[model samples]
Target: MANDRRMTTDRFFGGVGERLENLQALFKFVDTTEPDKAELQDWLESNTAAKSESTIKAYVGFQRSVGLLELEKDQYQTTPRGATFADTGDPELIFEALLENVDGFETILQTLDNEQTTTTAIQASLREAYPEYQLPQAVVGRHLEWLQAIDAIEKQQSADRYELTSFGKRLLQEKLDQKPTIDDLEIGSTYDRVELHEAYGGARYRGIAPSADYPYVFLFTGDSGTEHGYKDEFRGDTFIYTGEGRTGDMEMTGGNKAIRDHKEDSCELHLFENNDEAWSVTYLGQFECVDWFEEQLPDTDGDHRKAIRFKLEPVANEVEFTDPDLGAVDTDELYERATGAARTDDEATQQTTVETTRTIYSRSEAVREYALRVADGVCQGCGDEAPFLGNDGEPYFEVHHLYRRSDGGPDHPDNVIALCPNCHRRVHHGKDGDAFNQELISRAENVESDSGK
Candidate 1:
């Protein structure tokens, strides 16, 4: 929550360059101005880059909103944060105040978390989140400019896209108790850099994140990497992925070793295409490293080094569906296996196709099947029988995760519940999703607990 002062004040600002230099001019005006409320606008426009009185007023409001400027007896004054920045010449203090005091500052950062976005995308997101503000196009652009001005986000030189900076990531993690809000990751799916790190760790700045905690070694490659000649592309049936190492020789160590020996370690290889246009990556399906060879490549430091590039072939892991074979396993055995079982990804079983493979994990399968079986042709949420029969001639139910898969929630019996379509929508899209989810949570706990007995 913003302070009462910030909550009531207007945050929209206009006119002037959305750069740090413009802001510094304002601080100078404040230092030189006399304590006169009536002459403040004149002083601002004349002393600063703002040419219009309205822009000057807007700047004042913006500064006040961020705790940079204060109104003392109707005269313009600087706050402690403002005074400190003015004295020390540090822009971090200004950005800190913006993140801490502004209503939509942090929201904008989170919106950019997964990938870089256009000014238009940022505007659309702001409208969706804070429609009441109804900020104009220019106001929104100014806000983004402020973010870039403070180094929280960087504008791509070639395009209008804005990418989050390392400093911005650090601020989000350290200042705000923020993490990825992604609920689940469907195979053949796409995720942003931020969500990738949240799901498996080890993927933000590197080409290959070891992802030892998960069942796969995640490979990230994008058009950006092509700049350094660390290009990852496809050749016939093989997806060629270059080894990781910025400087010196690219050795078969760390993430490179992880990728080379994934098969020996019982780890799968998951390939994602990092989008050049946006900040997200698309899963191209799972791959198997059939071969690897050393190649001479120029490192970031401009040294010719030996790099290990891997030959990846599409993995066609087979998964057996249980719908046809339902009830073949005894209830006791089903409960035993399904209890606390987990999976590599969110999908309950692998998709049957040899291309663009999706996971239908056996463990997640157990979680889904156990929930559906225990429901006994009933809707878990409403205590009513399923709405209709599926193509398999059984009650139809969609499994809902009490905790999200992207948040590292397990695909175990305790974390999922089966619900009818109507009940499922109510849990996810209804007016009170959390409240409705709470109802299902209780029912799921009861269902899992009763089966244990």
Candidate 2:
């Protein structure tokens, strides 16, 4: 390890119970008055819980070291993070500052990722992380207190043990993950909180983040809507996104307005989908709002309300390419995803978001690969060998869904059959296509049952 390293250390002001509120209080006080050291001590005695001069002195120095406070000439002033926390009382803004300016604060939370740890263990980590500093037990305790105050961590049932709360784990994931480079923002790439916001500047929360600094509006949608009883879905190629606001009729304001006016504002609308990864979302490429409509939906309070659902169309049609490496593709993993992606009309989970398009694409691709692998160049429908070999030197055969693709059927293995082009077009365009397709559906079902689905 390199000996040259930056150290971020905070002193235990007052006691081990030093917390975010104390810093918030100091920030509030300094917004109005440019107080000198004695004046600050007197103000702290009157306005804060700290009355001792020693504790007050420690508070000033600690705040200064953490970039929360600045000593200009002789008076104190709050930095941007400090000022923002003072005005909004939003802990995460302050948490961002702690991430940059306090050691052990983030280290302790990371150490407790899946398990609990003690103050002694945290102190040891701080000692290792910042060898130049004297990180005592009190320093670790104070860091733990701040984390607790911000609801990022909690004390375990055991008196000495501590662990990250759910919020803590998520916060750590977002703050610690590496920001994606420009090339990494592909159509299906996942990002920590944001890849676009950092690249172009926008709100980091809510469904929409309109950048005042740039001509861009970012829209996020997903199955996460299921959590809040809101619905977002993909109706064919159009993504139906429910506007923001959990309760009451959603008005044309904030994120909703930004998305609505994206075209007139000349701001590009970039779409992303919520994924399973904590503090992360998958980029779904750019979309333009073609239309919007109001519908009756339950709010967070479960009350019926009128909400706007925007119909967004992709700016450019996505071309699906057959993977040249399909021979080496993991069929088992693709099978699981394909089978799990059945189209659901469930009101609760109509929130398929981009899954219907993305997952269906996966589902069909997997089934085609699967059926071809099973057929050994023979057509399931016609019971004939393939007419020719493909460009890849593999026998050419097509996978046909029993239910037509236009009907929005799932591409599960049990519902698809390997067919030669003659049989494929016959089922689609022949006068006896319906009966032939029905017979093939039964044949496909039996085939999948006999082998694999």
Candidate 3:
């Protein structure tokens, strides 16, 4: 029972009022992962008043004692209560915890009582009030240090005395009245102002979707009202080909422009839900634009028009969400990083260009060459000869995928076909594109190897 009473005594890191602020700092330091004592000390030196190892030790001990942290081996991690306080940023809850645990810290506050006083004055007052206890000036200074650390009291700009902050006064009043306040409700977040308008029904902004030429962090809002309604069918992590519309000659502007510029190594994509709440713009991590092609899409007037469709692949990282600052990273280096290759100093300085390195699979080149050799200067789709010869003195027909690599298609010879440029465009954008694909599937060799036929 005696030890229990001692445990019940409230103690702050620096002294009475400062522990919560210290707790806040500690939580911020270990936002999602545990760190060692040296790391904590380093963070304190950079972010807080405590600079020495001794001061950080005291602060960490105080936090551990108050159930804010759990030390395992050499690392410190946040307790569930610590996480809650960090997420909510509720000062009152922190204060309540302190009041229940710390012993004589409240006496210091009661004595100061919202007055503008110096540490010298506080010491004299404490001495006068409790002459029998014989509290030292250092103890009084320590308490004042804590109060100041927590911003319960601040030094006046014109005078050398300390005064209570508005937050300090509200805290004191709420404790006295035993009343509670609520947290601010979240509105919309994540989507930019223009995205918000497009997401809602204010106005339809053309060229908003991400494209190959200028890959953007496009939102795949899986909602019923969306133009393509792909969101309803989207499941897990996979590639998507966008519905087409809004075309230009050799260039797509607006959303189409963004997609047109998307390079597999350079573009970025994000998925969000169509929850229609201000705060519901959840970040679904970054994705890679693997491939794109033009497809026929119906315009507003229901007429078929050429539109650019994009294929996206996910970037797997240890962190749950990463909001990369695209401008800070060189576009060339960004692609290199995306493709899992090291960029030398010279390569990083060069202008942004599409890289032809292996990313999803290394055998893609071998498969393409094998399929081209099998075609032997003839377009398999149209039974026509190659339109031209290449520098290698071979037919220049392109290897087309029966299934997209982004959509779990194998990079094998059987799943690929050689096509003339005209037939390639016809299969991707013609009115009978689906029928043409079915025809290829029936005749294409070796495609059934992975399908358990």
Candidate 3 regions with alpha-carbon error over 4 angstroms: 1-25, 36-52, 118-121, 124-134, 158-160, 178-453
TM-score ranking from best candidate downward: 1, 2, 3
What's model 1's TM-score? 0.37
Which regions of candidate 2 fall more than 4 Å away from where they truly are? 1-18, 124-134, 179-453
lDDT of 1 at 242: 93
How well is each residue in 351-370 modelled by candidate 3, as lDDT tens digits? 24644333232234344555
Each candidate structure's TM-score, on Cα atoms with residue i matched to residue i, is 0.37, 0.37, 0.31
Global lDDT of each model? 0.66, 0.69, 0.54
* Least accurate 10 contiguous residues by lDDT in model 3: 1-10
The local distance difference test score of model 2 is: 0.69
Residue 168, candidate 3: how far off, in angstroms?
2.5
Q: Write the per-residue lDDT of candidate 1 for residues 276-372, one digit (tens) a residue.
A: 5465877676778878998888877677878788988666422333434545656655665666334445344453333352333344455567778
Model 2, residue 229: C-alpha shift (Å): 67
Q: What is the lDDT of candidate 1?
A: 0.66
| Better by lDDT, candidate 2 or 1 | 2
